[model samples]
Target: MDSNGVDEQEMKLVQGAAGYVLEDVPHLSDYILDLPTYPNPLQSNPAYSVVRQYFVDEDDTVPQKIVVHKDSPRGTHFRRAGPRQKVYFKPADVRACIVTCGGLCPGLNTVIREIVCGLHYMYGVTEVLGVNCGFSGFYSKNTVTLTPKDVSDIHKRGGTMLGTSRGGHDTSKIVDNIQDREINQVYIIGGDGTQKGASAIYKEIRRRGLKVAVAGIPKTIDNDIPVIDKSFGFDTAVEEAQRAINAAHVEATSVENGIGLVKLMGRYSGFIAMYATLASRDVDCCLIPESPFYLEGKGGLYEFIAKRLRENGHMVIVVAEGAGQDLVAESIEQQDASGNKLLKDVGLWMSLKIKEHFAKQRKMDITLKYIGTFCPLPNFNSSYLRFLKYECDWVHVSDPTYMIRAIPANASDNVYSTLLAQSAVHGAMAGYTGFISGLVNGRHTYIPFNRITEKQNKVVITDRMWARMLSSTNQPSFMNPPNGATEGAN
Candidate 1:
């Protein structure tokens, strides 16, 4: 006999004699009739009850024919996903070129090296060329192809190994040369002026329907390239300035007699001067291009230094190379041999004014010390002076009189340069045309092609808010006073 409740696959029964049949039973949801009706065993106990049924039928069985619905969570209609695919270039097919124009920065070589290696090894790019003398090299057929081995040892080098030129780009000739040599791409490395040239070249290339890609790499110590965090060489320059200021501080302290005037490089922006002062913490007064001063004003640097000399006996001043000294010296302007007003050196002028004021008011002969040239590299015809021998009565310091044009760049700067180089390679491989590889938020990013337009090349000046913050009287409590004295104390 077979029980009708049993599934067909499991139906089976065994029968036995004597007019009685024993049948195999299927599992049932409830067996209440099998339990004692009154006073059922374990029913009185609250913990256990054989009469109570907890199991129920669930419709979870596998279907005979599975149907995958598109809207279900496990649907098969979702789009395929994978890692991002990068565009690559064949080594033989890529004929890339780079040019460096204008003043040299500390990390120009590092950017060049990374670009060359990234192209050749990672992107299968070959025929990397170096354009000598900037845009001029691109106009003629004098470009030099750089091999993987050419840039192997340039990781720690300072300036661009390919050389640099100030010549402007000749677009028609450049396009002609690119077409003639079958160059696929070009990278221009430089500051504002170089970017302007790059824009022209890109426009010309686009006009002719050339298949060449163009990219720019920002390399300026000024750190003035807008829309980017910072330029490559700025860190190295700031480090150099900090070291110089530290040395000046030590010399200034030991002598206890003379004022040292250190002039820093910042034709427009005072970022270098401000950062260097923050690093050294020994700068007494800093004159930046953003802030102009009058010699006889209430909060003038001259007056502040005079007051300091009367009390502290010596001072240290940091002046940007581009600060307006003419306005400061308007009261007593003098001319040189060529009939040009021999504008007093801001350092010397301030030093002289302080000395005169102290001698007249306090009746003391205060010694004056002037130490200029805050740039890492030597400037043209600038004489060096020893701190103890030339400026002070003490004589234990090193002979700072010798000029040093080249110094080892900072480690931080080298790291930044490497990043910038890698970024340039990435940008070029991605077919990013007419963009500069820049470092921002600690990552390598691009400054778009349009930001370097001719009209946007001007440097931004410090607004009233910045001027107030940097002002001696209105400075924040955390900022050290210009006299190297703590605020709210004496």
Candidate 2:
């Protein structure tokens, strides 16, 4: 039986507006799920039931599905399976594989470690393989044998012990490798693109009449995977961003007419910049990809910065990398390895505009310093901003992108990643494939990959969280503000 409690042959795929084309995926039957009644050694203890959910059968009159969000028409249905339940595969015969993909996240190694440990400690599955690089590891013979002891110290380190890469989402070749290794279960650690690849691998496994299980551990530093309350490594990213913001704050306050500009990582969302700005409470301006702001109008960012400088003498600005891409002179159709659109250096562009506007004004005693590797801060001589030139005291710009991403998991992420990894392994052992382990509504549950990647998780400007962030930073709202404030509440 599957999550919907339907027979395997009766299952059919159903497409939704969100683009998930799967429904009623079959779970392993009792015959194939040949295992002992007690897979968990601690199942007999009453205290152990705290972490488990026994089979639930609700009243027939009640609705079985729940509306996910008010903005979406679709809802999520319930699924069965908990800690005490018997796992589908027998431990001794199971040969599992783990693969990490996409960019570096703080909790990659932690997830890998926990999964290896759980498979070994909980199920007695001794044989495990780590696929080096991304899906390409599945294409070639790049694999390493993994044991609990081998990954005992990996959680303390950053990056994956198995290594990772992008753009190797070849499903057929990956399936071929799985068969070659006789892998019965595959755990994938990655973001949306990588999970999409996992989905393809699962479908291919099914098409080949193989009972292999494929599970995903949600991994977007951006925290944009939909339906999950929060993705692992997001809290760590936000925490690390505060250090950069603090550096900018220190630089800005240290000089007489200094402006500190910090750029953060948010491709299509503003959660990182917003949360960092809120947590740091030192930013005069916060910009994100989801919101666009003018550089020089009456209610524009230029006047806002000038006002702040005249009042506070120094100001700090936090901008997400994807913010203000629309303002660039040319369209940026180029994408990165993970299918994300490459954004122009909005922080650099805005800094140049501020320098030009203040210099042209002449009466305003202001200097702008921009520092970052994306564009030359001091030497950026764009033809577009060549009409006016002015000298500013200094613009301190720094990108903590790589530095922040390569660090070990923070305290919060350590717990979250371990739970996600444990849930992923348990799901696979329970014959749940084509799913991503996530914390939905505070519960550790298996979310179908199709549902997980159905939509991009962008910050809702109308949400109270955005409102609180704006309130904390005292920044002008790019979107309409509450209580009937002006168009761009300043």
| Candidate 2 local lDDT, 394-450, one digit each (tens) | 433446655567889999999999989887877778776777878766666666677
Residue 143 Cα positional deviation in candidate 2, in Å, after optimal superposition:
0.3
Clashing pairs in 1: 91-124, 284-482
lDDT of 1 by residue, 153-249 (tens): 7756666687777755667888888888888778888877788778677666655556566778876676766646677777777777766666666
- Root-mean-square deviation of each candidate, in angstroms? 25.9, 6.1
How do the predictions measure up, each by TM-score?
Answer: 0.66, 0.84
Deviation from native of the Cα of residue 30 in model 1, angstroms: 75
| Runs in model 1 lying further than 4 Å from the true structure | 1-84, 325-362, 373-408, 453-490
Clashes of each: 2, 4
Stretches of model 2 off by over 4 angstroms after superposition = 1-26, 30-75, 377-398, 480-490
The TM-score, computed over Cα atoms with residue i paired to residue i, of candidate 1 is: 0.66
Candidate 2 residue pairs in clash (backbone atoms < 3 Å)? 369-394, 369-395, 370-395, 371-397
